[model samples]
Target: MVKSVSNITPFTLLDYPDKSACILWYAGCNMRCLYCYNPEIVFGKGKFTFSEMISFLETRRGLLDAVVFSGGECLIHKDIIEQIRLVKAMGFLVKVDTNGSKPDVLQSLIEQKLLDYVALDFKSTRESFLSITQTDLYDQFEQSVQLLFKTNIPFEIRTTYHSELLAKEEVKDMIDYLKFNEYTGTYYIQHFKNNVETIGKLPNSHTRLENHLPVNTAVKIVLR
Candidate 1:
């Protein structure tokens, strides 16, 4: 079969909350986020085939509790549904990290009960969505969010905050959007790590996030 996974993180306790997991870093992404840290994964080609990945996972059957399908965008893969089914059949819980551009694929996974958890990237407010992600799929992202809301699966909505790309007001708008949609989950604003090379040249964020955060909002906003 054709290769699709660029690399594999043998183990991680951080990526998947409360579960010991391994990360499959798939190659390529639909969006060109300026602050994307995985420039290599986004622009590189896969080094491992599905068979290779499964063989690797087979060894960790009992050691690992879950598998994190992270990418460039895991849902963009044509055979993602089947691939996920194979993993799920191995008695391993599955989690997907996505940009929320492929709601149709997300919906399919939800309907098939393939996903145990999800980490959705809420790039920015609708007005600056295109400027940030370089994609005009805010509607699709919103659709994905709504789909998750109707499901019983656990999920978290997070944003990679960069002082240059997004303002405190935009973050408030996103919080407002989530509140308006009746989302009662934690909204994470992760500060962009400046140590790594990004897709675009970005300077280190000097602004203190705590000072700019909205006060006493209904949605639980956490800075990571």
Candidate 2:
């Protein structure tokens, strides 16, 4: 029922906070964001099966503290819950990186106590969701954001920034919405890194320049 794992980073201190962990990159995505960095993962075929992933994890059991299920939309896999359960049984904390499109799946996992941490992507404001993420699932993302707030689950919500894709003013609107909804956590504004593998390119003038965000809101914005 699972798809495939595109790649694996055997160890990383940066991926998981306060814990050493391995990162498993899953193949395919539900959204086609213009500034997506992992286009190959989103568009290409995967190399390893779920069994292979388990075998690798088995080798690293005593060394790493956690396993990060990153994507190309990791939650889209039908067998993710079962996979997470197995990983949790293996004595490793499990973290999932997602676009927040599958809130139902996220809720189910959180309720079952299968996840340790979640990093959800918040693409853009409600009005610009479609144009920014190139998907019709804005409402789902909003619901997922709200759902996480009510849960006892530890999580972080972030948005990748590119001046052309999401303007500072538009991001302010999104922040306002988050404040109105009482989103109590920090909102990350990650600078876009452009390269040949980028799914969609920005205008020539804006390509590698980080969006200089101003301080004007109640919500915390972390730059990455």
Candidate 3:
């Protein structure tokens, strides 16, 4: 099957923790978060094929440390599990960036030892989930989060802070959901950068919602 990989960043030191890696940006996503900056990949088709990506990876074997599969929700692609396995076999650590909507794929990767790190987006609380994602994926998203909490795989849970879709109290609710569920991992409060096209109306320029986040406990918070 043809994979929906849209673009690739040959190298970056920031994407994966402490590793020199390349980014595989996939195409299309199941949810349409209003604050998302990657609308092109989320709504458009990919330009490259799975075989092409493999050919590219083949050339980076010794020079790179890891490969990051970010998307348009990388796990939405069915062929990702096999691709991860292939990359792992090629002697490179694999990191996947997902919105935590597919626990089955995430679990499969963990069980098969196909990934080294995971960056799951904790978009919103159940109350504001539908408004943010524009999908009935709240249950599925929660399942992925809980599954990650139980796994040994290293992960970073993040949220896009937008004043238009979420408030200070609601942001705390999202953080609380993680803490209540025994999640003690790092939770990043990502401030929405108005650099690209978003799904819905844009927030006002002064809407710095990240500054309003409530103090959270038990988990490490990295403000960006």
Highest lDDT: give the candidate number.
1
Model 1 residue 114 CA deviation in Å:
0.7
Instruction: Specify the highest-TM-score model's number.
Output: 1
**C-alpha lDDT (0 to 100) for residue 91 of candidate 3:** 95
TM-score computed on alpha carbons, candidate 2: 0.91
Please report, in order, the local distance difference test score of every candidate based on alpha carbons. 0.92, 0.84, 0.85
**Between 2 and 3, whose TM-score is larger?**
3
What does candidate 3 score on TM?
Answer: 0.93
lDDT of 1 by residue, 87-188 (tens): 999999999999999999999999999999999999998888899888899999989999998898999999999988898888888888888887877888
User: What is the alpha-carbon lDDT for the whole of candidate 1?
Assistant: 0.92
Question: What tens-digit string does per-residue lDDT give for candidate 3 at 1-224?
Answer: 56588899999999999999999999999999988888898998999998998899989989999999998988988788988888889999999999888988888888898878999988888888898899889888888888888888898998888777787888777777777877777888877777567887875534665456555477678888
The CA lDDT at 79 in model 3 is 81
Give TM per candidate: 0.97, 0.91, 0.93
By TM-score, the better pick of 1 and 3 is: 1
CA RMSD per model (angstroms): 1.1, 2.2, 1.7
- Which regions of candidate 1 fall more than 4 Å away from where they truly are? none
